[model samples]
Target: MDHRFVGTAELVETPSVAVVVDVMRAFTVAAWVFARGAEKIVLAGSLDEALAWKACRPDWMTLKDGPPAPGFDLVNSPGLLRSADLGGRTVVQKTTAGTVGALAVKEASLVLCAAFVVAEATAEALRTCESDSVTFVVTGEHGQAEEDLACAQYIARRSTEPETDAAEFLRRAARSRAATELEQGLRQGSHPDDGALCVELDRFPFAMVASLEGPLMVLRPCPTPSSTGAART
Candidate 1:
């Protein structure tokens, strides 16, 4: 399969499959939320869109950028999701990079949100899809973030080599500029544990595949394919 990595979302074009990587936060938070049993997550391009979605469906949770909203059940933080009860609940989310990148590539035959948490599963899912080509999109904050690029490269490696070293990839990501910034933020008392959560690889075993449903980008989990076929009797 042909694979290409784009540094930012703006340059993304139609491909058989597009994987959006935002390991510093965004998609990593999504993975944890799903792991906590979130029924579904809707991706919005902006804070206004996320709030609007909340207005339309008052029962759904809405997460925005910046600090956590007073009445909101969750925010854009993986550390917060670690303690939230998301069972049987749906969430609407808007972030600076991840979701925006996913929404930007509506033309992709398949769209998958990727982070270290689901890296291996995402690779397996892409292999199962058998697409002729795949594109890994690094949805950095404003420009390119080293952490996102690292995660994308890790995913690309795994898509072809099932035995790729996740630990080595994460170790490298932790040394990136984005990770350093996050670590500094933690030291300054901003969600102290979030930095560690962001780099935790393979925390979840499912891939989060997205689909455009009306005005929302809906994400759902898919189990990884088994490595071996059934034996002949």
Candidate 2:
């Protein structure tokens, strides 16, 4: 298997398998939503698109950042979603990086949304699927989003080397620019424990796979293959 890393929407070329990662929040939030029993998450390219989609399906819930948009059931914050019970509910998610990056890679045979929370499971899934080449899309910036990049590297390493420990990678994520900002936000009570929430390595035991269903990029959880053993938390 060939493992490599790319960045954001513009830089990602179609690979055999693509793991779109947004560790600071996006994919982390997705993992939490899935764990909370969300049926699926529809990835939208823009806030307007998300709202329009939600309007068409009144039962579908919307998750996105506020201030710029008005009709969302939840913000793109993992801390707020910690206790949410989204049993069988479908969520339409629009984010600045994560969803955009995911929608850009629809050409790939397999597209998995990833974060440290689901890193090991993602790697195990890749191995089980027998993918030839996998690209990690760090959906923060081209090269500056160290938190996302660190997660990509960790997943890549885990996919290839089964026995690797995530301690060092977690350390790197903590020192990233995004992590620093979230820490400051935590102290100010702006985001409140969101940084701590984002870095909870192996918090979820399944990989979120993005499938193109007509015009929607819907995400569903792919539990780690049972034969690959349990994911560490």
- TM-score per prediction, in order, is 0.90, 0.92
> What's model 2's TM-score?
0.92
lDDT of 1 by residue, 80-160 (tens): 667788889899888878888888886678999998878878888988888878888888855467788888888888888
* RMSD each, Å: 4.7, 2.6
- In model 1, state the lDDT of residue 85: 86
Off by over 4 Å in 2: 9-12, 66-69, 186-190, 227-233
lDDT of 2 by residue, 47-142 (tens): 888899889998989988643246778888887787788999999998878888898788789999999988888888888888778887888866
Top candidate, metric TM-score: 2
Q: What local lDDT does model 1 show for residue 33? A: 80
Q: Look at candidate 2 and give me any clashing residue pairs.
A: none
